[model samples]
Target: MLVTGASRGVGRAVAAAFAARGDRVAIHHRDSAGLAASLRASLPGQGHAVVRADLADADAVAAMVDEAAAALGGLDVLVNNAGQAYPHPITEVSYREWQELWARTLAVNLTGPANVTWCAVRHMLARPPGSPPARVINVGSRGAYRGEPGQPAYGAAKAGLHAMGQSLAVALAPHGISVASVAPGYVQEDETNASYKVPRGPDHAAQSPFHRVARPEEIAAAILWLADPAAEWASGTVLDLNGASHLR
Candidate 1:
């Protein structure tokens, strides 16, 4: 299994869960070498590898995927959990800044995953005869449906990601590769993401009836379920993990 952005936060949790399941994990991070290495060392299993690549760079993404596949022997699952969100409200930023934010956010949150999936599927297609269908699980955001007023690009990219997963799900079914995505809302921030998070307060918790935000582990659990062999029938489905915060 390979989990992008596995250095921390939800990605870290996903990687840990898979590792605990006795799977060898490839942890991918853009620049967080220290964190990625730490995660690889702390994981429960051996053979875990740490890989780095700038997702926005297509060549780098291909190389990274190949490296991971070689290191882990092969890839049975891919978790596209890497993403970026920049708060650039239309009214608050200059036109140049707006363009910059859109390009950067889309590159990392949408195009990057698309490229990564392309590379991974190549590996999946080569699996031995009778192997179980491979799984591709993308970590999307509820903002795709609920709206990201302060970060329109992030919302748009996530919406695109969801659509892409559905399209690939259908396209890859015949090849025995399942593609699905999870859309989560307001997950509790970890140390690595504290600066980008909304301050924890009653107002923040009130976003859901549960009066709280999601834990990384909770999101990981859903992702784990989606990657199960039994979930092959669930390809193209976008599972919502928002705790009833935003119904569509």
Candidate 2:
């Protein structure tokens, strides 16, 4: 299994979840060498490998996937969790910033994973069908549907990823591969900690059906479940882990 952005946040949790299940993991990080080292040491298995590459670079992405596959002996799962967001109102956003935002976000959130999936699917198709099929679990955002006012690029990229995952699920089904997207809402990470401090009046807790923001582990469990072999027949599924927050 290859987990991009494994240094922190939801990616870190997902990596730990897979490790707990005895899966050999390839932890991909971008400049978080210290955090990556700590996570690699924390994993239960000895085969866990740490990979570093700029996901926005196509060559680097392809090379990273190839190297990770070699290190893991074969590719079984891919969790595309690396992402970037620039929250700025359209009026204040510059042309250069907009281009940079879209380029970086789409590269990591969409194209990088698509390239990795292409490589994984090719590898899976070459092997005999009886073995466990390769799984690609894309980490998306509820912002894709709810629409973050200031982060248009992030929302658009993630929306594209959701569509891509749905289409790939059907396209890869015949080859015994499964693809799914997990769209999470208000994940309680450092990035969202400030938002939590703001009071939403009396009905704030009741706004979301779940009554609170999601813990990273909760989202990790969803990813793990979707990647399970038992979900082999489940394809083109977008498991919205939003707790019905968007309903209101």
Candidate 3:
């Protein structure tokens, strides 16, 4: 299995969950070499390795996919957890800044995953059949539905991601590859994250009526279940993990 942006946060939790189950994991990062290496070292089992590349760079992303396949022996699963979220409210930012932020967000969150998925699909298809279908899990955001007026690009990118996964799910079904996405709301980096450190406020407990925000591990567990071969029927589904923050 290969997980992009596996150095920390939700990506880290997902990587750890797979590793704990004895599946070798390839952790991808743009510049968090030390953290990636440390995560590889700390994993419960062996065969875990770190692959580095800038997702925003097309060539780098292509190479990274190949490198992950080589390092992991085979790529059966891909988790596109790499993303960026920032406040780029139209009211505050200038036109130039607005364009810059939108470009950056779409480049990383949308185009990057699209490229990675394309490469991974080709890689999986090259392998012999008879095995279970390969799986691609995208980490999206609830902002795609609830709204991200403060960060329209982020929401737009995530919405595109969900659509892309659904499109690919149908296109790849014959090839036995399942693609799905998870949309989470107000995820807390961890309990220790400073209030201001979080996008919406650390006191997001009120948002869901649960008096608490989503946890990284909770998201990981859902990813794990969705990756199971039994979950093949769930292909193209966009799961909502907002703790009822926004019902649709």
Candidate 4:
């Protein structure tokens, strides 16, 4: 199994959950070597690996996937949880910043995952006959449908990611690959944290009738379920883990 952006936040939780399940996970991080190393060491099971790659770089994404497949003895699951965001409110940012952020955000959040999934699918296809079906779960956001006025690029990228997951679910079904995505809302990096500790904490909490935002582990658990073999029927679906914050 490979979980990108596993060094922190929701990605971190996902990696931990999988590792605890006795699966050898390849933890991917862009520049968080220290955090990634610590996470790999903290995982309960053995045979876990640490992989680094800047998702924006196509070559790096390819190499990283290959390394993970080799180290883990082939990929049974792939979690695309890496993302980049720049709060460039169109009215507040310069045109140059707008263009740069748009490009960077889309590259990391959309195109990069597509490339990584493609590489992983290739490795998955090589598995011996009669093997269990492979799973590819994408970590998307409720902002894709609710909108991110402060970061339009991020919203657009996530929307594209969801669409891509659906497309791949259809395309890969014949090959025994199931694809799905989770759209989470206002997830705190830590599961135990009760507050955002920022000015908008109350506002974010109020978004959900539950009076709180999502915990990383909550999102991780949904991801874990989607990766289960029984979840094959969920392919092409985007499960909402947003606590009803943004109903669609």
lDDT of 2 by residue, 1-248 (tens): 99998888788899999999999999998788888888899899789999988877878877888888889888888898888776766888889887877777778778877887786676667665566768989999888988978878789888999999999988888777899998887666644224423433436446587687778899999999989999876678878887788742
Q: How well does candidate 1 match the true structure, expressed as C-alpha RMSD?
A: 1.1
Q: How far does residue 172 in candidate 4 sit from its true spot (Å)?
A: 0.3
- Give per-model CA RMSD: 1.1, 3.2, 1.9, 2.2
CA-lDDT, candidates in order: 0.93, 0.82, 0.90, 0.91
lDDT tens digits, residue span 53-164, model 1: 9999999999999999999888889999999899999999999999999999999999999999999999999989887669999999999999999999999999999999
List candidate 4 stretches off by more than 4 Å.
191-200
- Give lDDT tens digits, candidate 3, residues 20-93: 98889999988878878888888998888899888899999999999999987778999999998778999999
**Location of the lowest summed lDDT over 10 successive residues in candidate 4:** 191-200
- Over the stretch 1-248, how does candidate 4's per-residue lDDT look in tens digits? 99999988888999999988888999999988988998998999789999999999999999999999999899989999999778999999999999999999999999999999999999999999887789999999999999999999999999999999999999999999999999998876453223322333788999999999888889999999999889899999999998888898
> Which portions of model 2 miss their true places by more than 4 Å?
190-207
Model 4 TM? 0.96
* Top of the candidates by lDDT: 1
- For residue 241, what is the lDDT in candidate 2? 83
Residue pair clashes in candidate 4 = none
Sort the candidates on lDDT, descending order.
1, 4, 3, 2
Positional deviation of 7 in candidate 3, in angstroms?
A: 0.4
Estimate the lDDT of model 4: 0.91
Considering every candidate listed, which one attains the maximal TM-score?
1
